[model samples]
Each structure stands twice: as C-alpha cells, then as structure tokens.
Target: MPSNDSLARASGNVKWWKNANIFQIWPASYKDSNGDGIGDIQGIISTLDYIKALGVNTIWISPMYDSPQIDMGYDISDYESVYPPYGTLDDMDQLIKGCHDRGMKLLLDLVINHTSDQHKWFQESRSSKTNPKRDWYIWRPAKYDADGNRQPPNNWMSCFSECAWTWDEHTQEYYLHLFCVEQPDLNWTNEECRREIYRSAMEFWLEKGVDGFRVDTVNMYSKPMDFPDAPIVDPLSKYQPAGTLYCNGPEMHKYLREMAAILARYDAMTVGELPLTPNTKDVLDYVSLKDPQLSMVFQFDLVDIGRGPVDMMKLTGYKLSALKAIINKWQTFIEGNDGWTTVFSENHDQGRSVSRFASDAPEHATNSAKLLAMLNTTLTGTMFIYQGQEIGMTNVPKDWPIEEYLDVGSINYMKLIKEKLEATGASEEEKAKAVHEALLNINAVGRDNARTPVQWDSSPHAGFTTGKPWMRVNDNYKKINAAAQINDPDSVLSFWKRMIGLRTKHSSLFTFGSFHLLEPENEQTFSYVKKSAEGDEKALVVLNFTDQAQEFKLPTEDGANWSLLQGTQPVEDPTSAPLKAYEGRVFVNFGARD
Candidate 1:
C-alpha cells in the first residue's frame, strides 16, 4: 500500500546523486584562510574556483569536525579530527583533493546523533559509573520528588532549552541532551554505539574520497525504546517537548537500515537533515529506490511554514496559496513516492531565501533572488545552494543588538523571549518593547541569516577576511558581492548561472517530470507545470508572490504559443502580460498539451 505512485518509479539508476546542485558550507562563515579570524580548510580550498563558478555540483561542508566551537561545529569534539579553527587532517586532505579536482562533490557534515561533552567517548562516558565508556552516552537515574526533590529523568526538553536532563555530578547520572549541553545524546541503543558511529564517524569520510553525508540531526537518531513520559499535550504548555516522543523514532527505519548497509558499500550521497513533517510515508522510508535509506530528505515542511509563536512579534503573512500548498504537498508526495527531495530555500539553518521567501526590496532584491533561483532550479529536488545564496543574500540588520547574536539557536531563542517578557509583569518599558519586537521576530527567522560572510569582495572583510570576521559581514557587501555579482549578465549571480543552465538544458525537464500544481488555489500566484514523462518535454513555472501588479493567466490556452523560457519580469505581451512585482517566468511548450 505504499504508493504516492512511488515518485514516478525511477530505479533506472541515475546517480551523481540524481542531478545534484547542493552547496551549503558554513565552515566558519566560508573563506578566511590563515588570518585566524576563522574559516579554513584552506578557506575551502581557496573557494574551489568560486565553487566551480556556481554551477554547483555538491559541496555541503558545515561541520568541519573535531569541534569545541560549542554549538557552531555542532559540538562534535573529534570524529577523527580537523577543526583547529577549521583546518588540519592535511586541511581535510586538501578538501578531498580540492573537491575531486573541481568536477566537485565534497559533502561531509555528518554529526552522528551527538558527542562532544568534550568527547573522549564523552570523556570516558562521564568517567566513572563503571566507565568502559559506560554505555557510550545517554545516562539516566534521577526522578525522585516524593517531596524529596531532585527530579529530571523524564519531562525531557532541551532542544536548547532548560532541561533535557544533564546532572552527572560524577555519574550519579542524568545525561541525555537533545542539543547543546555541549551536545551529548549518542547511545543509539548501543550496538557498540552503532559501530562506533559507523566506524569512527562514517568510515573516516567514506575512506577519504568524501562524496557524501549532510546527515546532521537526521531525525534525531532513534529513541522511544522505553525512556517515556512526554504526554501532557498542553496542560498550559508546561515543558511541552515531546516532539513525538523523540522525533521520528521507533528505530528510525531500523537505524536507517543500519546506515543503509553502510551506504551500500560507498556509492554514497546521503542528505537527511529531516526535522520532519513533509510526510510522503516518512519520505518513502527515506528516499526509497526500494528501501535505499536516503540520498535525499531535507524537508522541514517549507521551513516550518510561516514561523510564528515564541513570544511573537509579527511576520507570518504567507499565502501564494500557502506556498503553493506546501510546494505541492512535497511535490505531489515526492512525485508519487519513489522519493527523493531537498529543494531548499536557504540553509545553514535557514533565513535568507532572498530574506525569507523572496523580496528584500532594494528594488526587489535581485528580482527576489531571481525568483528564488527560478523556484529552486525549476523544482523536483536535489537543489540546496545556501552559502550566501548566489549573490542576493539578505537579513541581519534590523538593529543588530542581542549581543550581535551568534546563534545557539538564536541565542537560546532570545533568552527565551526575554524570559517570557519578564513574566508579563511587563513595563521595563513594556519589557523593552517586547524585546525590541521579539528582535524583529528574531530578525525574521535567524540562523544568523545563513551565518553571514562569503560576500567575497567589497573588501574590508567582505572579501571574507584577512582577519577579524567570525561573523557579521552583511552590510549589504557593497551591493552584494562575489566581486559584484561575478560579471553581471543580469546578476543574482547570473540568475544562478541561468538556472544552472536550465538544469543542464532541460535534464528530463528537471528530472522525470509530471508535477502539476498550477494555480492550486493561487492567492498571489505561484503556478507550475513540468510534464516530460514521455509526454514530450514542457515547462511553465510563473510566480510573482506579490509586490503588486498581478493579473496572470497563461497556463497556455493560447498564451501566444508559449516560449519565454527564463525570466524575472518579462511579460511583454503574452496576451496582456501583467505579473511584474516579484515576477518569475519560465514557459516552454513548443506545442502539444491541448
């Protein structure tokens, strides 16, 4: 019964990780080399020819392991070294031999469900409770309170909050740390802690040739095998942190089919960020090429759709029919189930899809970052591209003070919204105007807006450092850099190299196409149309998501016989073209389709 029709049944084997685009790279705000102000791995092997001139073939990065950067390198400690201010292990073996001599494909960033309580196997599993690395991590034993106090082995919590247990006091016990008590959590039902987390951190980078793994926090690595308690639903929301009693648990697909039988003896590429909720049967049990445990799975339900609540301060107006009904409900359930997905809208923990879903209005931020790179390179999947999103990066300047925030989940969610506005006894001038309007709704969903830097030009640190820049560079890097939009042929990094050269000149119209969400209750227009499952290729797209002028129609009932092919704002007479505001075109039907 598992059928969305199985994402257009494609087991015909099409790897290079199914037409990847990737990119991510937070490595200390990408590019600093030796000046010590962070960023290394020889500043991403000297920007691998500016990420192979942005046609992006895959470069994930992000963790740069051996950490103690607390939460920055996601507190790893040492999964086989390399985080001395981001370089070593022969600068990650020359960044996997300079991204396989440029035809790129590096990945890495696989944070193994946790470690780094200064990990020496969590300091000999908190040294004591019979330390033969005492159960490798996740401890327990506190729950007292029969008015005798000492209570925390249950009501979980810490997703950077106040309590996902912690105690220890010399192994009297209470460990678990669902994020940031310097990380901890591991014990994956200890099959020798899942074979030393897949042989000391994923077979030491797939035996050094590194071409996969973005898996950090891949559904919080299996839980619920007993450690219960989280079911108070909402008794006035107190300690409400069950996240389905430990996110996507139940032996998460039997420990992702034991790391997909060691990533099927290495033809790699894994993806998996998956904070969840974009369900197509748990994303076809992790990108099913008939049970293949992940080659795709970012899906955070369109970045938690219109993020609101948490001492709110406005910023949730969505409706382009709620982002085309959550991107056509995960593009019609991963195009009928054979599943694979990742089309990302900003990453390094989001907030800069041209400033959260388009339009940073400096005359519509490079036409809304070229209509979010023509809706993530004419959708279908494997797109990613986060590092300073092409060239139109935005956000991080709505009055920068919360101590110039360096995200530990946006500084513990602005000190838990200034301790719930000083417990509503308000007025310290209304709790400093509700924490400066919740730090302008946490600077519109922050993750330091994709951790700043990588502007690469407008110098003085925008060229990403000769020193002094572990963060904070987005002073619109002299009108967005990359040496001023790398030879601007109508920039936004040349409409992301002309939508990655029309996804390599219509690669099966964005791969095995048949997605159709056109005007699915279009409120501010987002249209769609792919086709090509042998119905002789087609395209379509549209867009606009508001700024004003809207009137569109062209699902081609004779829209002057479709043609345009790529646009930001060019209607020019498709039977009375209107679109404009954040316009994005695309069209293509050389005829056929009644």
Candidate 2:
C-alpha cells in the first residue's frame, strides 16, 4: 500500500528493513549455554528457532564485542573482538550463520559514542599529553575556583548522576565521560578518530556479515566546541543537566552522512538510538528520504512520557491523552515526510510494556498484553519486540531490596537519594521511610526491571541458566514462563504469534497504510483506522486502556459492514456491547471507499 510517489522515490533502493519485525536480545540475560551464569553467542544461536517461530525476521543483539561490562557491554574495549565471556570470533560467526540459515537478519549493537576506558585508544590517549593518540578523546585543563582549588573544566553532569568530567593526574588534565567514568566519550571531531570508528565498528561488522547496525547514543557523537555549564535545574545538586549541549550538536549530521555513505556500500540497515532530540522536524534531518542518514531512529518521547525533567526516578502518573498525542505526532509526521521511525513500547532500558503502559495485575494482565500487541503491530512502522515482552514480563517484585538491583543507573540514583536524605539531617526512621519510597519508585521505573533473566521454563533458574543467573529470575516465572504458554491457545505467547502473523499477512495495510486517529481525546479507549493506498482495504483498531468496561461508537460514515478480524476477548457485536477491561479488537473493511 505504499504510495506510487513514495515507491518511485525508493525504486531500486528498497530496503529489507522496511517490512522487518525486529526482536531485540539483551545477550547477558537471554540464555546461557556455557553454565557460567552468563549468556553467550552459543545461547543466542540456540534460540534462533524460538525467535523465528515468533514471526520476527530480524534479530538485534545488544553489544557482544569485547567489553569490561561496566555498563553491561555498552563500554566496548575492543571493537574487533568478542568478549571472552560471550565467546570468540568463531562463536559470533555461528550466530550470524544461525540467523542467516533461518532467513533472519542480524544487527549488532554499535557503541561509537564512547569506549571503555580500558580500550587501547583511551589507554594511549591518557598515557601523556605528548602521546600520538592524546587528542583521540576529549581532555581539558582544570579550572580554579574562588578558593584557588582545582575543579573540573565544566559543571556538566554525567547521565549516571556524577560530574561529567573526570580528573587525570598523570596528564594534568580532566577528561569527559558522559556516562560512568569507566566509559570515556570519544572525540568525534578528530578526523582520525572518526576514520578509525568507521573502520573498526562499521566495516569490521559488515565484513562479518551482519545485516546492519543499531547505533547506541547515536545523536551524541558530537559535542559543543565551547565548554559551557548548563543552567542549574536542581539547586541542591552540584552538577547540571548538560544533554542539550552535547546531543544533536552542530556537526552531528555531517558525521552521520559520512557514516551513512560507508554503510550504503554494504546496503546495511541503520537504526539509531536518538535520545534528547524530540522534534519531528529535527528527527527528519537524520532519517528523511530527501537527505538520508539513518534508516530510522528510536525517539524517546513515548518512553519518557511520565519521567521527570531532571531525574527520571521521580515518577508520576501518565495521562492517556499525552500518550495519544506523542504516538499521533510521531506516526503522522515521520510517515508524512517520507521519514521512518521504530514502533516500540519496550526495550532493554525500559520496564516491561505490560507493567508500564498497561495493567499487570492478575485480573487484567493477559488481556492487557494482547491489547498492547494489537496496538504495536497495527501502527505504521517497523515493529521491535524486546526479549520477554512476548510472554508478558512484568517489573521486578515489589518486595525486592535495593541491594538486589544491578543496573548502574538504578544504584547511582539510590545512592544520590541516600546522600540527599543525610544532608538534610533526617532522623533514622524518616530516612528509612524515604529510602523505602525511593526503592518502590525504582522498582516501578528502573532499567533493572527489564534486565531480569528471561524465564524460559518454571525451573529453579527459570531455565535461563543451569548455573545461578547473573541476575535473579522473576519470582512469578513459575506461572508466567514461556514453557507454560508455548502450547496454550489463549496464552500471551500464542496471542503474540497470532498478532505478528496478522501483521505479516496484511503487511500493506499494517506497514504502509495511512493512519487516522479516531476519538483522540477519549480517555478510556484508543482507536484508529488504517487505509490502504488503493482505498480498497482498511483496518480499524480499538483498545480499552482502563480497568473498567467502556462504551465506544463505531464511525457511522466508515460504514456498517465492518467484520471483526481479531479481538482480545470474544465479542459477538463489538459496537453493541461495552468493551471489557483492557479489551482490544481489530475490524477489517474490504469494500472500496466512496
């Protein structure tokens, strides 16, 4: 159902990713074949059949390159080598072959924004100010305070709640690290640095036969030339939010174009993790067909709906209207401009879709999961299914203590909370209460919620690993594991299969069709219509987002011959009866539009 004009523009340039359903695998928690309490390439190769059976045609594995695991593989020390814990180069080859043999494409996670501090490039860059590789990373001389004490070059804050600049006494300078101090930001402004990245990160993987790359922190490759302090948003905090100064800097598009030119040689898929840049027009600069850069981008607006401005841990209730506006804006603007975007509700860094966007309560969990599946597949974009989302994984248990959390972000945020409470001189009882509330909020919104090991079966370790898992399996795995639902007709797993199959069977209507939101202000229901390019095929999707039944009216003008294609709950007449809690339905109209 792609428009003739759009098709003409992409003639002889059609990409396989246009219709692909990508499944993301966070390798560490996916499965373990070595019994070493960690997942590896062999474990992923073992599960290729299971992933393909879910109707996904592409698999995007998080970083498996040689790393220190400070940020769980995001901090790459060696771009050309596989981590010893994961496997050797031969194991990675088998994973690529395993995916190719199943007719599935593989995308390796690319972390070029920064590298592990232990990387050889950084090691030499920091050895001395006169080293040949000294300029490979950002380094600035220290500044003096009013008390004549040495301080960092700027007041920029790290994403992990610390000063962005780290002092290096050996070089007599401070270096930049936007994340953990163990991960240093590379100097993309250096032409030699950029050349090396293209050679090692892109060309090396393309030679390995990967289908494409998923660039992490893609928009942050460039930083402002002038070191500047961000306006103080948190008076009590010493450092300030500096993402605006670094994200989508002046030279970002130039770097992307250079990277894209190289990727074009292999005709590879390129999806970038574009954080902090939310405007659709700004996003189009990177993904628009007029001036192509990335194949698509993962915009954070939808996931960041209820997060606080300064601290993501400060949680609040999200309104359905806000969610609807974000979806409508991205879906319409991106597609309308001949740009592309990924449709996803969950990922490695987010809480489970069912727990975050829908109800995860026992009474509504299954139905709500199906409802979310319907919404994701019906939208006009490539779909990405995070691991464990297909079987309705929820957040970590509420009773879990703070010590069990493993994510650096979660741990850092909690540490900051404890320090703040102490600074206020709160009593021990008051401190305990404040800490407990913070832990509850982290349980609800932390990255560790999705980092729990996958529940393959109801075994001691949920069948994820024979040895103890690096992370704990959710306690509810006994009732919710994939093994329990693989064969059940009404299980979340089966429902996901059906939903994916429906999207595939009608790819034109689901992928390239025109989207029209229905009842935009409705608080209890989300409904939309997708019309094929020829106007002969149309699909109407209706979803109830609340815990109570809600009445909805079908559009009289769109006609009365609509037939129910699928539903989360059985319904004889969808329009006549009120929708049950968390219910969803899809109706198809095959007649030509007037």
How many clashes (backbone N, Cα, C below 3 Å) per candidate?
7, 0
Candidate 2 segments exceeding 4 Å error: 1-13
Tens-digit lDDT string for candidate 2 (1-594): 456634432343546898899999999999999898998889998889999999999999999999999999999999999999889999999989989999999999989989999999999999999998899899999999999999998899999999999999898999999999999999999999999999998999899899899899998988986888899998878899899999999899999999889888888989999988877789889998778689999988888888898888877778898899899988777554668767999999988888889888988988989999999989877899999999998998899998899999999999998888888899999999989988988887899999899999998899999998999888889988999999999999999999999998887678767788988998889988887655677898999999999986666674547878888998767866789999999989887463
Best by TM-score: 2
lDDT of 1 by residue, 1-594 (tens): 223343343335567787778787888888887887778878888878878887887788878887778788788878888877776798788878878887787878788888778878888888898878788777888888889888877886777655777788986888888877888888888898888889888887799888778887788788875678887653433454666678888787788888878877888889887774455786677788787777777777677677753322246666668778888777667655566666778787767877777779688888888888898888876787878788878987787788887888778867766776666567798888877877887788777777878788887978788878877787878888888878978888888888887886776666546678865786787878886554556788887877888886665454435777788755567534888888788878754442
How many backbone clashes can be found in candidate 1?
A: 7
Compared with the true structure, the alpha-carbon lDDT of candidate 1 equals 0.77
Model 1 TM-score, 2 decimals: 0.34
Candidates' RMSD to native? 22.8, 1.6
Q: How much is 484 displaced in model 1, in angstroms?
A: 32
Q: What's the TM-score of every candidate structure?
A: 0.34, 0.97
